[model samples]
Target: MGSNFFHHPNGWVGTTPWWKDAVFYQVYPASFKDSNGDGWGDIPGLISKIDYLHQLGVDVVWLSPMFESPQKDMGYDISDYQAVYARYGTLEDVDQLIEACHSRGMKLILDLVVNHTSDEHPWFKESRSSKTNPKRDWYIWKPPRYDSDGNRMPPTNWRGYFAGSTWTWDEQTQEYYLNLYGPFQPDLNWENAECRAAIYEVAMRFWLDRGIDGFRIDTVNKYSKRTDFPDAPVTCPGVPDQPAPEMWCNGPRIHEFIHEMQAQVLAPYKAVSVGELSNTPLPKQVLPYVSAAARELDMVFEFSMIRLGTGNLFHGKYMYTPFPLSVLKRHVATWQTFIEGTDGWHTVFCENHDNGRAVSRFGDDSTPELWEASAKTIALWQATLTGTLFLYQGQEIGMRNMPASWGVEEYKDVESLGFYNEAVESGDEKRVQAILHGLRILARDHSRVPFQWDDSPNAGFTGEGVTPWMRVHDQYRELNAANQLGDPESVLGFYRKALGLRKEHRDIFVHGAFKLLAPQDESLFMYVKESGEQVGLGADGNRKKALVVMNFTSRVQRCPAISGALGCRKGDERLLVSTLRSGLARGRVEELRPWEGRVYLNFQP
Candidate 1:
């Protein structure tokens, strides 16, 4: 309904930059591709796939950790600060990745995991070498409790993010070091100025000088903890056993640390930051990090929306539960309202490395017939929302979740395996069942399955002769980029169109004010993105407007036309995009088929 290029009233809506306008595609290096016959994906593999990304219409690529590590947490636990992982190639391979991306007019960013390092890291090795070692203070270490008796407990009642006690005793040094995650991954002490400065160098100077664009800050909210080092408070009302990460998440001085990092590094390079803030639901806890005045981060990712719909009776995140459409509506609407016209910004993503496949989690991907419609419906929603669109690799092809019959042995994620062992030790079959179901639905492995590039053996991800790092999802034949790339009705083709529309209509999709139009209906998630008064025909091309009505259920819904609800004339609404054959008519009446989404426009040239 407008020109090929749409500009905001000003150069941008409100000092917005390319970060807010670009379409993001996340790549998990271990599974994206294998350049060498080694089965594991490397930087050169990513470089080889750059043209595929450009052809798919993505402008920004966010890679998961590719640094040197023990693979305990899939590279999340850093062993070396400046070198790339041996399996993922060398430092020169990383340089080639940056250059290749820039040549294609795209930006590449690495995952910044500074909150903790692998126990094998030189800093931790020396820190645990002896209590008096100069590097001992680099990590959070304390003496065991009950000094009077030989037997003792951990310093506090804190819990690890993966499972068991957060404190691990070091045989070399009598003191216990805090490890909020896996046993091999110890938390770094940000209060120590030296530790802070060194992490700053890793996050700022080193990579920035290497020609990389920016970072997706990992566990950004957990960088600081209370000086008193008290026990973490329980999060749920009755679930006392749950890890109380609330004590460290959004801690007292986290903002200060981020502000310093931003001032020292980000400002100079004009780089962007998208912080992954987890384990909290309060908007107040997250807003400060992304507020422009706060100078902490450019964008903040809150998990409440994804959390509220997942989990079983045991916890809120790990277990599986059908996502209620009404809950998602409320959660997303709250975020959209909070960041409107403010210095802060929002991020839209249905799945990441930590989450499950969107088509399987939120949409109905139980059968072959439901796959295409379901994936397109959710992908369109993410692309049109008023924020940056983060699309995980293989999402464009509607990759399904792990096989239903597969056992936990098929999973490689440290958190999933660790928690499963804990449940098995408790001798609680019910708890074990919940954990297994949760792993199938919400585990990190669900998204970690190899990216399906084609129909070859191993889905064209790794060499046929080599074994992939993780098992590829079994349904790669029916759903893969090579098969769906040209089919207009295929999920991959739909994604290309959605991404193109987002780029062409940035003003309407990225800057236009968002309003939830049909909040009362649990079966529908309907909203509008418009900027100016809804006048009659012949409006200026600068007036960006789009009305999106989505049926999130599996059954056909009798959706009444809301021309009035969207402040448009009966005939002004013109269907621009739809997953169903029967698109929206010019009037106030209609029905949406299962998992159908329709976008309407105001004026057409």
Candidate 2:
């Protein structure tokens, strides 16, 4: 089916393909594993884990940047567009990993980062050399302006996504360069047709030739910027846009770029594409990108829930407001309702390498029992929803947040460093402490901490005397995989059970309609998915239907009784799986143990 057809949710109306329900697992390469003991994870390391992913029961594997990079921004700072990083082994290693995933009946989704390029990249090198160079127009450049006092002024007021000014003055070219990220990462000028075409070509041929199932485009909507580069009105006190970022983010030409990408590249292969839409409001501008015309993406990841910890001052000053569950449920419910009747698809995620653990954010991770239950409940809630569920590494094992004691030296994320420097440089010790503490709760390193495969040193990710790039969590001794695989109540086991239900009841869970019930309850997060007589892809034609009730609050609570279509007396229902007990009597209105949840299979009214 064509890209345009993806917008209609009516199960591929008029030859459009349907992707309403799928599961994607995000893999961060460097922290994933180390095959050659270099202290960094590689592709061969990934090839060894294909079976593990298959066992986890995910349909897609979304690998983080493996493209050549300077490691300045981890792998997000790309130096080469086409070549695989040598530290990750040869291109053949990637080929082998792709084949392994496909052989197990799973698809691979490459992380496509097109927003900016590393300063070390050859294209940037040539473009920044001289004003008259043929590649000069490839990046956003501007002539410096002199202030009334003769001091040079930036062309615009835009600040970097990290921190600092977005413009860098280069005496050599006598021009200022535009960068929404770090100085080393230069934003490409999408207005330049040559540059745009080059990016599209690179995105196309790689997946087309290599047989990748799709792509998860990172910072995708930022590809287009405002034309005039008008100065943004002040929103925050310190963070001002030089001609504002609003002028640049989601520019007028964005749809054109998406349409071109779809027409020239994505459409021909019938490949799936999802944009990582940052700072963009949902059910409005973001939704159109994934609209029925298929002009751009298969789905877009809206970050409202991810930004919960930020409060009102999200990116500016800091606060310790533990994200409220009410706020989380509201945003999720609104988004789900907005796309409930659309052909456009939604990409669901609770954790990613760039964020902290969901187990820590949503549940009590300090204790083993609560940790296991919370992790299981989160997995089921996301998986059973009506979109592509994205699971981050270490999530299956219910990884916790970074240790509060991990000081500056132990951190590797740029966001952490930027906040640390800003806090100290500005002499706000109290604010610094708060930001650092928040980092412990929200930074990507918490998720990137070494995968606890076993109780071995370095959490089985590296050997002794080999320093890891980041500190591994200290709980590896007790929380490692070797122990969890034996315990059915472990977080890993609960994940298996959750994924198993998703796979086993594909028609009801994967492609079924999501009916969110009891939205306002603070203690109970309840919902039901009705297959309504649709048959799964490979089943014996038996209809599948289920009622999934999750108790989000960490206390015993009574879920709202189900009537109408779902037949249940008072509350007598067989417990399919529970963190505390085995059998549940019908119409009993049983108590839900703290952080506990249950699902009933073939439940009838």
Candidate 3:
């Protein structure tokens, strides 16, 4: 009956300047829209779609890399830090994109790939030309070891993030270049203060000067490295892989580097940073970036749920295993405890440009009706959680996973290809199947599919005969945003309603304590959000309190037992929204239909 408490030493919970309670929509520019009909998406095309995002009820937009690149890893390979890819558009086009987003009251978060750059980058080109080049120390380069046969060997046993050896021999320099990811994505030497300062200066000025929002720091955890450069002791053997990237990931001075960057660049601008700290655990590893004291990153995108294993027998070895529902509960619980105790912020998302669709990954896709209910239920969960909820473009309409039949040829992700090659070379059919199983669930290419704007030809992404860089999902005909916008009960509508709830009651949902009242029940995910008397725009506009309840299963499930509140009798429950079934008379105890969710007012106003 008491209001939920909020502890804020800095400022009001929801009134922070950097997107404290906003919903973010991610745009993978290459697949978002195409203006010149050049068969690829560009910035001008994104500018044309700002209206769509506004209507979708999002206040922040996170764009995948638009920097000038060789398209080797899509746009993740940066060739020019300040320039925009001509294929996507010019620098003018990027400037216009930022302008248009702000004009609509939306913030743009640029994706910064500082961990590595394309080999063709002028800096890298010069560094690799000769051992004594002026930029030779710009990247992580070392002399090769003379083997027993007098042949030079790689300096260490570091594994490439994209597969193969982390060290690539450079014939010109007679040395080896350190590559954490693809061979072309040579690692930057953060130990070199000059290299670090140059990138920070460019990034800060590029945005601070233009008044852009902030950045989504790509692989922010991977910038630091050990001085010894010792080989990682293999935990899982026969997998001649980088034994442990701990030697390089989250190194000694990463925090210092980030703090310096924050002091010079982010803090002055009051900008947001969503650090992409993949392959790292939350709470222990990811939470520091968003701590109030760190002042480094505003939020961190944790990948616990996104790494779940699908129904693949060979999931773990290939890193594609659908984690069970229990794993989801444990992860969420861990995050909730940390945020509740600290002045830390978290980013909530089911899908991004890097993971598979939510409904397909988490839903019990045995039937269509369950799919619909599950989608709405998940959206309700996303809305109520105390963080910035990011919805991938197609997620609004409940898009499912790419076809199971999609072969290796249909995939474009470097990670997936590398795993496949490793599996095939091992000559183990069982391992190959297991690896592909994991790839089916976690590959970045899943969320990179074209936006399902309408049921038009090619999902209206490109003209006929102009094949997209990746295959357009076939479900676009039935699942595009155009049709859903008009339907009251569509997934798109449910998302709009979810955002509307946050907009209507930002205090409680965004800034209040999150308690899972019924976490163990297999049928439901019930929780409550309570804001103190000083709070406004929470679950209860009145000084009264509100209780949030959701039924994750598809069956009429009753609350175990309660005294102060029952189902609907006494007008005690003001049903705000329901996914499966609604309409209950006052003073009656009842059950929730399968896959149903409802928010109720707990006390009298």
Candidate 4:
């Protein structure tokens, strides 16, 4: 169902959907935990941790792909939509997982990778069998082009997400098939009604029927591509195949296909749909997909917040550059204000399976002294925002980037490996070093390390003497969950308390009106959230208000006075939480320590 709005005593108040205030926890299956000593995390391992997740106050669990695949793109290249990957577990294990999550009042959502299928998939195999096969149109295939010297070339000069050309020639069929991602994963032809029907039956209905609460759609905006097969304009200099997001992303029929999926599967089951709308930056462009009136998706993940410091070169996002904190503040304010009172909703997240650790990327993770404080600061920043908050695995315990000493050989992510291979082939040592530095700061594999359960071997991710599929972070001995379980000042403890506060004051933190304070401050991020009487709720004349102030740098900064905005005098506000645990219960915070954050509840005059 869509958002419902009604008139209250003070004004109009919008009633949020169930997911609006929910806390989502995303688990990268292979890296979360391992059972059976197989060195790979599975459904059983997840089932065993249900109590821990519930204790962490998570409302929904979003799992990355666990479907049958060739493990080409980390289970993204699905070979069978209806079957579970053997390494992850069987169909029965998934059923048990559903039961376990539902028993605790938590919902489970799977990552839906429908943009492409593994080349080894039976349908793709049949389609490539011959030129006139009945299933030939199941995937996008076009005739090859030739140069003046009779050198055969692919259909278009569009680069794949992993690298190289988007088109891969099929020797048997004598045609080039389009694969926006890896060559082993062929894109489906959404224009074909039969193909669309098949995808809905297996990918959507199959999972929804199996009791999955909803889906986190992968590459949702890249389904429909320009059919004319035009060469991409040279955007990055010296690159033969240019990135053509403009032609593929948000194509003409993208909405139509999403609406169809909504009607056929999601709406019927009343399932939550959070689309990964990559390359769609503007809030206006994302509005149509998530607006209540559209009947498409419930929300979407926007990349603008995460791409803050990257550039426009060929190594985009893999190149690191320092950006002013004001730019990040402006982007957050813009999105928050744009959707403040609209039917559209947004997803608030900084860390996921795709990005570097939040603490390392955004917070000061330079020393042991700053780790917990900075992680708690990031947590407070996310908790106060107006959207569905997502916490990736290991974020609660302050997991960080892989150690700088490790080389490219330690990286297991396809993107990181591809970038390294390409960089080294150029024989430019300085350029390679620069790219490696960026990888150390921004590689996706940084987030894929095994979960640190305790100081035990392999971070307790796998049994002793069993090497995990990926290496555990080196700091696990000091940063595992067990070490922080009892310490109230630990990042895990702070997250539980912060999430509990958000739940306790759902109206104020979830549906409250947001106002940015000290917007131009380079070293501080401060905002106010007011609900209840101010937002047309609390007919009994009760008003709820909260003020959040954060120091974004390693140096102390004076917190700008927010007492005026909260309508409370200095020292009259109740201190709810602070990163430092300074033991001050109620007072005006005049100064904030390095990487410090504090929240307060305002007193009514």
| TM-score against truth, every candidate | 0.93, 0.91, 0.91, 0.95
| Candidate 3 local lDDT, 406-498, one digit each (tens) | 888988888778778877988989989877787676677788888777877778888777888888887778778888888867888888888
What is the per-residue lDDT of model 1 for residues 14-40, given as tens digits with 9 covering 90 to 100? 334778878889999998988887888
- The local distance difference test score of model 3 is 0.75
Cα TM-score of candidate 2: 0.91
lDDT of 4 by residue, 406-428 (tens): 97889998888777778788788
Model 1 alpha-carbon miss at residue 284, Å: 2.4
* lDDT of prediction 4: 0.86
**Which lDDT values do the candidates have, in the order given?**
0.80, 0.75, 0.75, 0.86
lDDT of 3 at 481: 81
Runs off by more than 4 Å, candidate 1: 1-15, 147-150, 233-242, 312-316, 532-544, 581-589
RMSD of 4: 2.8
Task: Give the candidates in order of lDDT, highest first.
Answer: 4, 1, 3, 2
Looking at model 4, the pairs that clash are none
What's the C-alpha lDDT at position 80 in model 1?
94
